[model samples]
Target: MGGPGGWWRRKSTPAKVETYTRWSFHFIALSEPTVIGVTAFGHLEARAALLVMVPVAAHVALAMVTASRALDWTVGRRAQPLRLLWALGAATALVATAAVVLGRHGPGGPGEDTGTVLGSVFGATLCYGVGLTALGLKDRRRVVLLVTGFGAGAGLVARAAGMPALAALGTSAFVTAASGFFAATSAFSIWLLNTVYVLDEARETRARLAVAEERLRFGRDLHDVMGRNLAVIALKSELAVQLARRERPEAVEQMIEVQRIAQESQREVREVVRGYRRADLEAELHGARGVLRAAGIDCEVSGETDGLPAEVQSALGWVVREATTNVLRHGDAKKCTVTVLRPEGRVVLTVRNDGATAPHGSSRTGGTGLAGLRERLSAVGGTLDAGEAGDGEFRLVAEVPLTARPALEVAS
Candidate 1:
């Protein structure tokens, strides 16, 4: 649980009301006894009054705080608020300690009863709502569970031990245990809802943006191809026009040049529009060898790329990009290795970086820029995987069947 809205997320009204009701019930039942009793127990002239106030105040306080966290968690605005927690915690402690001190040392008049100071200290938690809110803001799940559990438990225990009011109103031990259980469940629900919503939102947003950005990029590429090719074709056609006005042989040659450029431009434009960029495995390996050497990482290539399809080559080439990016982002990595191999009609590419980086998906940096690889490879009936292969080694692997022509032969 974290932040005002991050603790529990249900932006809708019905959902908001539902979560609020549960938390309110859990909090009131668990806390009311202690919250009111703590202050009333020592201060109340009648022992009966002390018992009633303790449970009532506790219940109300618990319900209020729980409801607050539930609503805040639902809003998708989770954050850790350490200062707020510290401030509220200090204030709660001060109140509790003061109650205890007053109980022991205060001057007593006739009909006055000095209750145990510890009760005041324990009851002081009624004020912990502020810090609990802060902890919820920070999404400190475990701490809230522990604190709530203890507070609810102690209140019930005190109630059963016997209050002066015929022992009628105090909650039983079983009720106390139940309150603790409910408190924990409430906290977990908040954390779960927030995490699920956040992840789902992130995935959908990434999908939309990825498609849009790719379209824009491919659009620009198409324009570039068309512009350059059309310009060359136009220049050649003008030359031919001038020649056609004179001797015939030169005009025919100029027309041939125009045909070549126009054809080439058309081919390039089609490829760009189709989002097809064939990579020659042989060339990539050759390039990788030099690039890795310059970057001071070992690179090895030993596969015969001659018969492999272009899709496989493109997939493998992407592996190189993702691996290099991981290396650049993780500076602690000292060495990197890229290996290409082919056997049994399958092409495999592996890139490994040695460092102290966590496994893939475990780090935020890995989440972005790598998701597309999964769908991209799957569309072509292949797969890409990234994770830690061993100690100090982060590895990315790509294997896809050959489908398109090799980059060297795209034109031929």
Candidate 2:
């Protein structure tokens, strides 16, 4: 359990964006009904307003469901909502027809106030329905055609219901503009959500590529170190065998040379492996900054790696690497700061990041990654402490005495 706010905090950036976009569509759909209800009540008597409200509310509800299903289809979460779209279209036409009838023959016999209120009902219901209906369409040109057709239809329908030519034209214009606006907004939201998912995937890919590149480099180094030495050892051993078969005295010297070369190869291989495993403190700091910035996180690094013992630097370099990895893997961090300082014969390294949430938990308290880091630090007599730092921040601190030596290796 990640506490009270766990559910939302645990969602990744893409999930959060999707949730926000979906709810925003629902809220927009709800507004159509809210506005119509309020306008009717203000302009008409209670009985007439109630009459207008019922069909309009039903139309809005259908539009909302259609929009939800359409979004699900757009994101590949569900099949195309063809039936729901057809149902909403039919409901919108029926509601608009009813509003036009009410306006022409109202309670006070077709007065201006009654006509005004019902006309708004007619236009709003038609426009919102057009917008939600457009969501099921993927082609931009098709959406444009749909909105244009509805605008022209609104005018023809109003004219047939005995509205003046100018008022009908005005209704057509209103539906066109409003419907197009809502449709464009919905399209943009879907695009933005997809882009967020793509960018997150690219970030993960870049991290994997970095690891693969390092492995290739290590492999190349190992081949270069061992290839020539192994060839020399094989040649000398064959030469010694041939000399001994001929009863030559130099066979002993030849075998001694082979042994010496074999021992030398062993020593060279150890050095190559050691150099590959060693992490330079300066290089790690620069790398951390680059990697974090590439992921769109603002990273600030302060202090120096100069004048530090090699063993101390190696241990802290690993701390920096592990800390940087954790920042990328967990949390929706925006800014990360790393600092190194020396005071009173002790070297200290600290990494801190903001946008920490409770659900992801601290990387320090549990995980094999951090446990391995703790073991590395212990070898150099260093200590690591990590936890929340208040105001939505997580911090990790590592400290080592300057005079600390590497732990002695145990003989196998």
Candidate 3:
């Protein structure tokens, strides 16, 4: 009842179409022997029919095994032994089928007729071809040659055994080989199509992972930029309230400073949110030295951050910034050291601070800043470790490969 365009509209997706095609070939492969058995039923006596069943069943079983091996090979697994076994089985089944089909009509007197013998040959050849093609051999030309040789040899043997039509041997051999060739190539085509589908899905999965990683990076950056500033703003606001209660004139200045920091923090958050926040290694190092010095803590930075990739610098700069923030906000330190070294094919950044703080649980364990830094480092094939060092010292170490994978490239 549907029009011509209706079929087109009702067509399934490419994945569904491929699945249907694969199953269709499987159905053909599984039913080929049955179809051949049914066609030769009327001509075959009861004993002959039973005899043909042996080779037919073996052929079907070998075909299934061959297809399984081909799939294994397609997915990059070992299948050499199975492929060799299938080849031997196919040859045996082909010979058995040909003999059973031709021998049914006695020695002379129109033995099994030419048409029936050729039809049986064609079906057996098709089964062998499909099974061989599923093997996914590298040299297709060799497969073609092998199929042709087998088909021709079968026809020659039939002619030598005095089949009815001797003149049609060449035609039957060519037909048998051609049918086998087409069936094998068709099965290979289905395998290739399914492989392409798998690659496309893998690409899609990588794309999704990229998007998710970018989101995480952005979130981490935002948290790192806002966490310390918000904490400082809260402390200052509290002090300003205390001063205002005491009617101190310094309350106005403190409130103004708090407002300025708040506004700056807001702008910085926007930069991070827009993905335009790139931390400068030199700037972070200089800032850390100055801030620690201002807090009466001796800070030493030993590193040459030049000649580093922008992405690498940005990632390392974030680490320095977060480490500095944690040192200032959490630890009572007398001295802090930041060392950056490029050894072999790696960039190592270590921030060690000697602080006498008891093991009072801090956000470094599950803090957003350190956690985000970890994620950022992971995205660039880097690692981060932050914990208490011996003798009341906390250390944060981040290491990234010098030839780290570019952020734009997705890892396979």
Task: Return the top candidate by TM-score.
Answer: 2
| Candidate 2 runs further than 4 Å off | 106-108, 247-412
| Tens digits of per-residue lDDT for model 3, 1-412 | 3797676557545445555555655565667666667756666665666665666666666665665556556545665555454574465446544653455444433454434643564545454544455355555675665566555655665566565565447645664566566547755665676677688788889999989987876666667787656756676778789899999998898789779878978888888766677788898899778756745689999978889877788889889888877777776889999999999888999999988662234335577777777777887889998878789888888998979786642111
Steric clash pairs (candidate 2): none
Residues 49-143, candidate 2, lDDT per residue (tens digit)? 88878887788778888888887887789999999988988888888877788778755678887887887888788778887888888889988
Predictions ranked by lDDT, top down? 2, 3, 1
TM-score of each: 0.36, 0.61, 0.52
Error of 1 at 408 (Å): 22
Encode model 1's per-residue lDDT on 17-72: one tens digit a residue: 54664565455445545555555655665665654455345434543554554445
Residue 361 of model 2, lDDT score: 74
Give each model's whole-structure lDDT. 0.53, 0.79, 0.68
Candidates arranged by TM-score, highest first: 2, 3, 1
Comparing 1 and 2 on TM-score, the stronger one:
2
How does residue 309 of candidate 2 score in lDDT?
Answer: 85
When 2 and 3 are scored with TM-score, the better candidate is: 2
Judging by lDDT against the true structure, name the best candidate: 2
